[model samples]
Target: MTEVTVLGAGIAGLAAALALRDRGVSVEIVEQAERLTEVGAGLQIAPNGTRVLRALGIDPPGPESRAVHLIDGPTGRSLIRMPLGPGFHLVHRADLIEALAARLGDIPLHLGRPVAGVSDGGRRLDFSNGQTRAVRRLIGADGARGASRHFVAPDHAARWTGQVAWRALVPVAGWPAEAQVHVGPGRHLVLYPLRDGRLLNVVAVEERAEWVAEGWSQEDDPQALRDAFANYAGPVREVLSRVERVHLWGLMDHGAVPAWRRGACTLIGDAAHPTLPFLAQGANLALEDAWTLAAAGDPAAWEAARRGRVTRALATAQANARNYHLTGMRRALGHGALRAVGAVAPRAMLRRYDWLYGHDVTV
Candidate 1:
């Protein structure tokens, strides 16, 4: 039987485990945190992402819990409105974590056992708990700052993208049913209903000169976030004012590593390609990575099959980040063009994203 050791139990990590497990591979997850926790606000599982979930046979929560709607971010106008399809859904990070964690029932998940270091040549892992283990395959899903990147690409450092994002969860009753994106000069705000409309997820991004602390729990002034989007019309101000707790972090971008794998070890998710949230494909891409990695039977063949897809996804993500941070004349020109085209033919503007949202990962 093939045995795999998955590091980090985030979306990518757990998804990898589930994928391998379905193939009758013995999989164990080692997580640094004491408990499986999700701190980020909310995530949208697009059709491409949802396809991966369905392949894992992990049925997500009921439709009532994950209401889906589409709203214009800048003007708060209703662009597209509809329920989440079976192929795409909205979910809280914690809920998805819990669901994925549950699916790996009886699978050994060693929590609080941080990976201190990995021996690439020896295929050995030194854990913070003073234990060592050797495995046939090592998965580096430990996240952006985790030990995996250091082991795989120590020379490459993550670059700050001159932007900070603040996320919060407020009562859903106060928010619109549709996912709202408020675009403005040098700033953007995204909001969606989560947890059966009981909680509303808010993500606000703005260009900044300095990098703030990384991670989802870092505190920033809610008022500051509000001020950033104050000029944006619609429900943004209302949502910002209602945020009781806000977690802010600098959105960092790293150059895509040429190779995501080294010898018997490979990288997944943020560990390999940390992306800005502009495209909202971070978690979705991670899920796709997990599926692709698991589907490959041979290590060598698996790496080759996945390398291109991973690279393209990462590159596209980087491109989207640049497009999202438009400033000055460029910003004005781009927005004017979008608005002009949108007014002329709204469906044409939406069709531009069809290549992205219409992707069928199952193919």
Candidate 2:
């Protein structure tokens, strides 16, 4: 029997365990946290990501909404709005986390057991409580700051992308059903409905310097986020005003790394690559990584099969960040052009994202 240990019980970790278990591999999951939970706000899972979930035999049950187009926030005009197809779904972070955790059943999950170190000798994992264990294979789904990254690749550090994001979830009783992104100068705001029209998810991005706190729980002044978009028109001000609680965090990007695996240990999710939210593919990419890693029959082939796809996904995410944070004259001209085209042909604008939403990971 092949025994595998996965670090971190996040979406990627759980998905890896599930995928591996389905393939007849004995799996043990070790999580540093005392319990499984999700922080931050809502996350949008596009078609590519949804296909991975179905492949894992995990179907997320909830209300479904379509993102028709992206719009210029200041002018209240569309950039692009295309049909998202059947696989696109949205859910709260906690909801998705709970769903993944529930699927693990009785699989040994050691919580409050933070990994202190990982050694290459038969994949030794040292826990915070002075305990140590050795396994045949180790998977690092541990996230951006996990000890696995250091053991696998010591040269990599998460780079800040000079931006911070604030997120919140409000009631959807009065919100639009279509997912909308409001783009502005040096900032952008996105809104969509979740949980069968019960909640409206809000995510606002702003360009910044000197603020480098990562993760989703950092406190940020709603007024500060509002001030960044003070010039924007439409429903942005109303949404910002209604926001009583906000979660803020710096956007960090990890440039492509050499390899996600080292010897008997391999990396997954944020542990392998951290991406900006511009493309909303962070979680989707993580899920895809889990599926690919688990589906690979031989551990030796892991790097070869995953490296190219992961690199391309990271690059696409970086390009999205640059496109979303357009500034000065470029921002204005881009908005003007989008508004002009949007007014004449909205469906054509929506069709531009077919490559993104139309992607099917099962292939």
Q: Relative to the true structure, how large is the alpha-carbon lDDT of every model? A: 0.74, 0.78
Worst 10 residues of 2 by lDDT: 60-69
lDDT of 2 at 10: 84
> Model 2 clash tally?
4
lDDT of 1 by residue, 64-161 (tens): 22233333455665433333334556688888888889899878998888888888552788887688888788899999888877788878877777
Candidate 2 at 326: error in angstroms? 2.7
TM-score of each model, paired residue for residue: 0.88, 0.91
Write down the lDDT that model 2 would get: 0.78
RMSD of each: 3.1, 2.3
* Cα lDDT, model 2, residue 72: 75
lDDT of 2 by residue, 259-353 (tens): 77787888889888877777777788888888877777675686677677667767777776677768888887876777677667656754666
Could you tell me the TM-score of candidate 1? 0.88
Model 2 residue 278 lDDT score: 72
